[model samples]
Target: MSRRQLPSEIRKIEVLNRKTGKKVTRYELRMDAGVNQNTGQRQQVKRRYATDREARKALGEIAGGSTDGTFVGRSALTVERACAEFLAGSHSIEPTTRAAYEHALQPLRDRHGDMPVQALSKSDLDRLVNDLVVGTSPGHRRKWVANSINPMLNLISRVLADLVAQGKLTRDGAALVKRLKRSDKELQTFSEADVRKLLKHVENNRLGHAWHLAFSGMRRGEISGLLWSDVDLEDGTVTIRHNRVSVGGQVHNKDPKTETSARTLPLTPALKSALRRAENTQKVERMKLGPDYGPGEHVVVDEAGRPYHPDTLSDFWRELCVAAKVKRIRLH
Candidate 1:
């Protein structure tokens, strides 16, 4: 076709091949990349592709990104570097959340860490979803359910979004990828009879007050991090101020999960009485052990007066279920 009849954004060009010293035909995609902020004039960019199809796809990305003010000139930014920078700059997230994101992004990093962010396409993301669904990705031994796979996709989406915002990516193809459909499962909870049995079994136990706190809807982490100063036995009130969560086999003491989670809660009559007994028992143990007993402000403690680890408390509850002959349910 004549130059006048050719598409405005794409055109064929001839270049000298370095090795053969012969002219080769290549398709060029040229577009208005938007005005440079440093200068008051418009900026444009050009890219050459071996095939018309490749040039057209890149043209689409540039057109969309330019229209939305998301386009920046191409560079050698790779998926691995983008992920690493995003994770490193994220300081506001909880440690547990950061750990979860790291795990979710592993597959993507392994599969496409070296791929240029500018060249990543929708088909690549789709193939990743397929591989994850069928458990065909490297290091994955079993198929992943939708619930398990969604978070990984979510992390990918977030990374892509950050890249676009930073002008490293022309557009976010990850947003076009569909999340897997999750199948719902019934939530299991303790029945009234199960609760009654558990309460009776632990009523006289050493950690009875701690069990009462769990039964009152306190999260396991909250109970593990509870301090005596945060509890008022006389006023029958408990303030939730801390949460000790396990991340990578280690526990971290942090603030409550949210602002609302740090509020005060009224203590039930049963809970109040349990707390009184626990306090008195601690006093007796302190006298018996003398200087050998460890001292702390924690409400829940072992015979040695050390605060319970969150994971250890979960294990303790599971064993308690079997001893109490009650149906097993996770103590959250």
Candidate 2:
């Protein structure tokens, strides 16, 4: 028998079988891996496999990765490490967003943290989503709706995307797993008459200014995070600079959600009047409570100046709607 020429980037080789003290044939893969940034030198890869099929499979992966400039070679990178790296390297995202990603990825970590990033398949993601939907995943005591579960899938997709960009993954496996079908629910809103009724009821309430802001289209977090300094009674303007949101039961105070979200708006006549009344009322409360008043400068607070969590504001608004005899729509 004579040796034959192997295909490009593949070579026939022989190595001693240490156990049997015999020589056995092996297929070897050799290819350029791209340049090393640190040393500015081209890199190459070489590996031997017991079979030709295995060698071809390994060659295709490396060649495809090199062609697309997304190959980082095989690694021990795990889902847990990738998620942590994504969160750590995410400097531009909001804290709430990062927290949400962490919350969403926790289940993936718990279930498949040890699995390599490249080893994760569409089936694994599908199963993970199924587990969450049925409340079988860790920490999910109740069944989750598609609307809630979809965001988790999106977060996973984002992590996978980051991995792909870093050459740790060839593609985002999460994207292949279709998002659970979300049920269509009619959006809830208040009619003019309902708005008027709530407005009339809140006119005499201590948190009237806060309700006015909500009616003016300010988000609950924007209202809760609004500082007294952000309100300009003389200029008749209010600035949206801060936003307070709760994630995992902890409240976080950060900048507005985006650049456009942090704009200054002219206050309407009714809103201005309500704000003045609120200021005076707060002053009176401060005088009564003296040192007991909350030291925070938040615009929306209780009589003792304690700032309300965004969720607390929503819960209280629902109560107010019931008392106002208006259709109790969410105060979002």
Give the count of colliding residue pairs in each prediction: 0, 0
Candidate 2 Cα lDDT to native: 0.85
The deviation in Å at residue 324 for candidate 2 is: 4.3
- Computed on alpha carbons, the lDDT of every model, listed in order, comes to 0.86, 0.85
Per-residue alpha-carbon lDDT of model 2 for 116-204, expressed as tens digits?
98899999988878888888887776787887778888888988987776656778888888877778888988889988998999878
Which candidate achieves the best TM-score against the true structure? Answer: 1
Colliding pairs, model 2: none
TM-score of 2: 0.71
Give the TM-score (vs. native) of candidate 1.
Answer: 0.79
If scored against the real structure, what TM-score would every candidate get? 0.79, 0.71
